[model samples]
Structure formats: C-alpha cells, structure tokens
Target: MKRTWFTHPEPLDTTTANELIQRYTSRQIQTKKTLAFDPKFWLVSALLPEYRHEPKPSKQYQNSIWSQ
Candidate 1:
C-alpha cells in the first residue's frame, strides 16, 4: 500500500507545526497506514483553525473546522 504525507510551503510556528505533525502521526498509527495531505489541508488547518474533526471529508467540514 502507498502512504501519504502533507506539508506546507509557508513557514509555520513551532507549536502549530508540532501539533500538526503529532496529529498526522497519530492518524497514521490509528489507521495502520500512512496518510496523504495536500497543501489545502495545511492552509485550511493553519489559517482557519476550525478543522480539527476526524472523519471529516467535505468542504463544509473544511469551512466549519476553519470557522473556529
């Protein structure tokens, strides 16, 4: 099986990046597989601050998650 990882080009604060890394890593472990993330994931998570829900797979999820 293939594994995926996501990151951003823009610089990130140490704390936030660490948090994201931890979250992604945990997901990888829970799924027993590697996960892929796109630039949009990073942008949405970082800029919006509302997309912390698991099993979220929609633009509304994106909007709601970031809205916070």
Candidate 2:
C-alpha cells in the first residue's frame, strides 16, 4: 500500500502524516478490542430465548456500538 501510494506526487507533511497514521492505528486497535455494548452481539443474544426482551436492532443502536 505504501509503495503504491508513493507513486503519487502529492505528499503529506510530516505532522499531518503522523497524525493520520496515529488516527489509523488507533482505529485499528479499537476494532481489534472486544466491545460489550456492540449491537451485533446484542442482536445475537436477543435471538436466543433467554434474551428475548433485549432491544431490537436499530440504526442508533448499531451506530452507538461502532462509534466507540
């Protein structure tokens, strides 16, 4: 990816590049962590008989999980 991107003439300044890399790395790390409030997990739980009363999947619910 870096090699291909290097083919482009436009270059990001050092501070901007570092900030971008940092944000990307932070997101990658966050995605790797287990999130208890994740809506997808709750949806599966809701499907189970024991958790039938759990809230249904909605845009707000899913977004809440991913936004973390």
Task: Please name the candidate that would achieve the greatest lDDT relative to the true structure.
Answer: 1
TM-score of 2: 0.28
Query: What is the RMSD, in Å, between candidate 2 and the native fold over all Cα?
Result: 19.8
lDDT of every model, 2 decimals: 0.43, 0.35
Lowest lDDT 10-residue stretch of candidate 1? 40-49
Per-model TM-score, in order, reads: 0.34, 0.28
Q: Give the per-residue lDDT of model 1 (tens digit) for 1-68.
A: 33343335564455566676677556553212222254323321222223345564677446666778
Q: List the residue pairs that clash in candidate 2.
A: none
The superposed Cα distance between candidate 1 and the true structure at residue 37, in angstroms, equals: 23
Clashes of each: 4, 0
Q: Native-vs-model 2 lDDT?
A: 0.35
**CA lDDT for candidate 1:** 0.43
